[model samples]
Target chain A: MDEIPPVLLRILRFLLERRMLFQLLEPYEWWLRRKYPNPPLPQFSYQVTIHTIRNLYGRRGKIAWASLFFPSEFFHAARLIPFYPEIAIGLVAALRFVQTPLAAAEKAWFSQDLCSYHRGGIGMSLLRLFPRPDFLFATSSICHGTVGFFEVLREIWNVPLFLVDVPKQWTRDAEGYVAEQLTAIARHLEREWRVHFVWDKPFFFSNRTREILLEVEALRQRKDRMLLPPTKNLDYLPYYYEFLGEETSLRFAERLKEELSKPSKTLPHRLIWLHLKPFYSGELPALLEKLGLGVVYEEFTTPFPEELSPSSPLKSLARKILWASEILATSRGRIPGILEALKRYDAEGVIQFTQWGCRQSQGMVMLLREKLLEAGYPVLFLDGDHLDRRHSAPEQLRTRLEAFLEMLEGRGSS
Target chain B: MCTLGYFCRYVPQELLEACGFKAVFFKPDFSSPQCSSLPVPFCALCKTFISWALNHREFSGFVVPLACDASRRTYEILRALSVPAFSLDVPALAGETAVERLTENLDDLARELLAQSGRSFLEFTASLKQALEETLRQQEAFFREWGKRRRAPDRIPLLFSGSHFAHVLLPLLEEKGFLVFPDLPENRILLGEEPLSLTASPLEDLARFTLHRLPCPRLSGPARRTALKRLCGTLGLRGVVIVFSKFCDFQLYEIGLLGRSLGLPVLCLEHDTTPSFPQWETRLDAFREMILHG
Candidate 1:
């Protein structure tokens, strides 16, 4: 399990007031930049974190709590700082501070079987750990849990919740429906935040971010070696989802490409990662290294070349959400995409990490395994909860991963 | 007529009937061998339905709604397995466009089912018109009887709501001397208080009626609380009993707020594939005492 710094833990535990916490984050931000100055990519992430924190609690502007699927582009255009409570709770879990919040959530009748991230979020909300939101926004594109999770938060905070319903299929009518909702949200934000809403700013940043991420993706495909750690790509998930329309994200993407362009050692075995890895610990990364397997591509950071148009911003964003992997994962739509990524990256095996409570991804596992095997690739399925360390079984995971790696090596040799 | 099984209440049974199919609500059963095939974390109710669908291949088809993640994926699994299934996309947000979207989806489904039955458009329309009229009449009669039951004295009137299982509890509640007014999505089919009309566009009316019905937990807004509050007033409900399957996301998230919002003594029960009937009996016994004595 990942260990939290003793000092940081003590500080977090004792910091009862949001104002005091906000004040302490200033030094914490400085300490982070000072500690991680060599690798600018991690520094960029830290900077975004500090910026998000300041925007959320610093009272600099309006803040809208949203699901990750709610494209940050809209918030950027409306000048509202977007705060993803799920992602925030995920960070708390990674920091190993989720236990208290999770317990509090359960006390409030949040079941143990629901998504842990959501449970942690609710716990934090009940404990008043999060800032009050001007509003809550969510998209029904990823998982139904998001909608319910945000609805509960809306009740807790007594805020207006805006929902953008993205259909499973990408028809013109569906796109129009989503675009209309997006437009309504935009108008609502403009009136509430006292700012004129325009898509030009968000469109420019999204287009640039997309281009850079595509380059980063190309670098991954072209490089025969895995330069970074096994779970390094998973770190870019937040950037891809939450900062996709921000300058900081564009800088991070460019820096990531530059970092990946550097030459590194090639591993004996290469695998493609499906879904998310256990983010609460470094054990999986350690195991992958020990087993001499390098992850060439992670599905969450799989970059698409679609361009955002300023002319019809809502429609384009709506189309993007409709075609997102989470929505398409229900059908056989993601299978072709995964197969293409596998061939492009030239990975030898697939590892599907099934996060607990994620029925959308778990439901697709059997079909994914069948299709990948039929295409002459082996698959190893690993089950773990991303946000809860209680579910982590290091011994079992190590044994399964070791056996899968050995089998892959045997297949390659034979 | 062939049978078309469904689990969600949003699916228009009238349309299915018009297409020469009997709309059967698939109740949760625990004995299917295929239950083990689903992911372990899936809610018990969805697992039961998927297991049953996998084993019972004799049904003409099944209609799966886009109400929840489990149900949506159930549709995906059934389709992948080559089981005859139809996915009905229900919008999560409510609005004028949302109603129109459901109407369009209903139209698409009507067309597909009509083609499957090898019936002409005019014949399907005529049947749909007639089915709508009959449905409104039947639902009206159900409400009238429910009203009379509500006025009956010396009985504990309890509102039963949650994820669509534990219908087994309706009779059990009655056995326990509780007047149960079921407010579940499946029960809403016959309990819809909205008066639907048969017009040139009967599909539109059906869509409006379904959307306007007591809002399910999956639907966005506080409309669910509002509708339930009105129902509580209308029925003079004394308490609530929410029965949901294990790991049901919608119910788990909504039940707490619902209980608190209702401002009444509430008992929330969790059902698994193998529910502990004795434990429920003990809890119900205690709940009965509290309601009757207090």
Candidate 2:
């Protein structure tokens, strides 16, 4: 199982050739690494995590595909190594093998109107790159497409699918509702897989995981914030870690926080990123760095200051999940925290990535952009797909980024 | 005089009617203006929901169920705009707890509506029962008449699924000797009697009816499957034509499940908010040929 399918390896080679196009920045990267000797390589950690999970898929064990918003502690409890479509597609795209699988998904009647990550994930399964999952689970009200994604997964795998319906308002009733579902999921896993979810292992990891995120958040709050974006290729950071309940994901996060303890001096324009950055979709980040607009904060990677209450572990996890981010029920759900970040980071402008095929984040961008503009911050909805390189036509993105930079320039740096 | 709007069928229509608030179905139009940047700005229904909710001065309030991701965000956008709104957290999966939660949400909305409009729900239900019973009779008559119609023996039967009908294509399908059981949810539940007459308390009756009805893909797996099985069996369906809107996670995800569990031909049709919607011409024709020839 350790040996990869030759066809997949060949496809990877096809993608890797084009990915070499990014190597032109090596000398500059080398210089930065030389400047900051102990910085975490976000891309390196990203690859490590993806490879780790992908390897788990190859081994003989129960595999579950979950929505990004699902609690990882449950998967750990069930002894299922988890993966998700968006991140999986991203890993495939980053490896340069997204097109064939994406084409496969499209051919299998997957709509182009869905998120590209979904298309890529579905395509992966269609092309026999990603094997059918053993079980499927998802959380409602976060990503609009995840339910649809998992529904397709259920059909493919013919597995029992569980959906955790997260409420819009995080009330005590909502907590109880979700907790009941989690209990049901545990029972289902035990009956089907014939294994009990050992409580203490996940309990230990969940608490430690929260601690690391808090440390990262505190470091991010330092007076002199790093001018550079996450040095590590931080694709699916929270998701990858939380899904496996892996302490390594936390270790890397701590490394990132430790690396960014000091500011990268001053930059002309400070921009706050709205969601997950498309790390593999060409050289947008490096290009943005060159344009002198530092991403002072990112909504996805930065942890919120949450008080952990572990008296009821699952309930506490549910509380953390709600507090970590806003459920899809409201427009202004995540706005308050993001607005606080924008102010704290002294962001001159904001840019939300409208990842192709993903309606969840993109659906909220209009209100997000409008709110930022009203709050006196220039904002842009950067249209691109995370895994599909075609979304970031270098010239078009350059023009949009430049236009946004000009708008930011209009507001002279204090 | 407050005109309240709702999108999903799960939101109690009888209750809204009973509360004396004029209810509007937030229908999507092809040309509804979209926020060019927001992905699925209008969701499965389309940009019309957003444009209609944001721009229209007619509605005093909009109540949207948490059926899917897009509508949920729509609720949020409406709230942000300070438009009077209620986002009922429709449980994505069905169970006793989920049903209880939904009932509570419905109760909360009822309270809000009654408080705002100063009308008693009980009074409305009492006055509306005779009319509800009459509507059921009309529905029964329509179904009976439909069943009595003589049709060619070779006609292909399709169980229509998804959130809404591809209203424009029904005639075409009929022309092709296709009989459709329109179970894609708005008012199809009207055939069931539990909501209007099962209990003296209209709210309790509505909650029970909503929780226990033939499920849409929005509810729990077993319930949704059960609903599909019941419809396909009762209709004696030969195939399923699911007309799901673009960017609808709930409907989009259920395509494979619909195909799998029923062991029948399922032609999934996608609808965008485009003027020239991508009609599944080839697929439909192929589907027809398969069914007819078989």
Candidate 3:
């Protein structure tokens, strides 16, 4: 319910009129690619990067804003560009302009307690910075924040919303029901957008998406000895990226494996970070390197999931979605997956980054910490906003992480 | 008898009743805060529920239905507490398959109850059949007896849409000479006659009746405007009241859509289900006065 921030709106009007949003983004994206070069990796990320820019500044209309949890495949099938304001919020945070949106949302009566993603998204929407969607869509979660985020969009945009609600418990019945809903939503979006969706079903292993993902998965199995660097766009890369089910991400994964074929000699402490990490600090991974802690794998990012085969495309995707380690409501399915990741990565410690305003993770922070700590693993339940650095006190985080790392150092050395 | 505590209306009460467990909705005194609760900038209802569960060992077990993130997390918290929690995976989208999903959830709950109660499948079936018959009977009687008796104050009554029952809201409204219908879908379990197919198995019939028939704000395409009009007309309703837990995106959409579509005076109150600020009272009083004296 945030009113358009005058300052933001004025700036956006200028940017929109001049079509300089992505043009302005050029320097930043260019810098990031340069700062994190490992050879042959930049092309894939570069390919995926263009679409994010194009969706906002590319053209007018035929764009759909979606929740992060909504799979990118359906949108791809519909030939509709998926614009996630949540990611936009992240971009703002990465740009260190998050406070403006936060202030706008709070001033407009959005409670400070609401997810920062919602606040940032609403604030951006209020500024008319987000692209106008022909329609809005979301994959529903037990978290009302997801639905609430879109509801704000629907109210502001007055566009038709297509919502696909998922179940907390993963059963064949739930999977089938969700598949049916996804199919319905896909068809609805196609009809509404006046575009027919055709699922890319190649005769066999098209584009080697399966081959690359499986190889990535195999690399993850022996991460202890592998020189795996924390992925550049870690969280969004595996699932949210446009490069998924295509060669862009495949080449990126291939390059990553080639680079990480040999183990790091100096870095001793290996850690697995849970949930998505905020990109507010560009030097976060470098900071981790300084701490002698390298993130070997992310819970959501690793096990590079296989290609979305068109066989029972909806149901198969639904099955993958239902059993998805990260998407499930609570610690039920996620815990086992995380535990598996911890052992597979041979993690010395685990950092459960409890993003600000995300209730799904907040709901399970204590339990996740409890189980991990109880299992003789050093666990740090770090509370920070994913997109808003204002909520994350860097000094406090550093201190806690230092302590956790110290503890892990002792446990590892002894 | 086992006392099974629940928070969301989506969890089947009659299903639990069939399993021979005493099901009770957990309503905390919204005016007072439990000091031991986990203070987060999120749903106060889930925080309060989790806060309460953190200490008390009153219920033998808990059934946390999948409604929103808070409740789902509350389930995780209950499990962490080792409180024999059952998290029901209710669907947000209602359809034939949604009915099947809910049926599976209901059956899972039954299985959990059986494991705890040592009841046979046959016993559960009989209890379910009896419960189904009784639910149908209640639905019939509820509609038949609607507006037949004007035993109370002649103030305009409002149809409410909310997942959690804020018990204190009713008393506060009643003190202001207003009537609030706690149930939104005409019946508590959505056992409305419109969506029921009277399937072969009594359990399947009940699942269809509970989920498929319900027009929860979470679900898409419920013919909600028509349904709201019919229910309101039948009850001689004057306005709609949307009460949701704070930060519940699910209810906010319903609050906005239903408010616009109904073309009636709508009052939205977002409570944390804890005893905190009593700011909602003034709004309710104003809404009540508008429907009556205006």
The number of the candidate with the highest lDDT is 1
**Residue-level lDDT tens digits of model 3 in B1-294:** 778887766788877887878988777665545424353555676766666665557777888886777777777777777777887777665567667767777787788888888878898888888787777777767765653433455656777666554565677766767666655554432323452445558677777777644466665233555567666766667887766776565564455456546767877676666433357777877887788777
Residue A212 C-alpha lDDT in model 3: 59
The candidate that wins on TM-score is 1
Cα lDDT for residue A82, candidate 3 = 67
Error of 1 at A187 (Å): 2.1
| Per-residue accuracy of model 3 over A220-292 as CA lDDT, tens digit each | 5564554434534363443334445444455666676675566544366777778778767765566666687
lDDT (Cα atoms) of all candidates against the true structure: 0.78, 0.65, 0.66
List pairs with backbone clashes in candidate 1.
none
State how far residue A7 of model 3 sits from its true place (Å): 6.6
* Model 1 local distance difference test score: 0.78
Model 1 chain A lDDT-worst window of ten: A1-10
Residue by residue across B1-294, what tens digits does model 2's lDDT show? 678887677776666766678888865544556644455434646345656677766787888876666676677677776778876767666556665777688778877778877877677667446445554576567656656532445677777765643665677678767886666442334333333355465555556557666677665265577667766776577898887777666665566556557778888777675533334666778889887787
lDDT of 1 at A305: 58
Q: Provide fnat values for all models in the order shown.
A: 0.69, 0.62, 0.47
In model 1, the Cα lDDT at residue A406 comes to 80
Instruction: Evaluate candidate 3 by giving its C-alpha RMSD to the native, one decimal.
Output: 5.3
Clashing pairs in 3: A142-B68, A142-B69, B30-B274, B30-B275, B31-B275, B32-B275
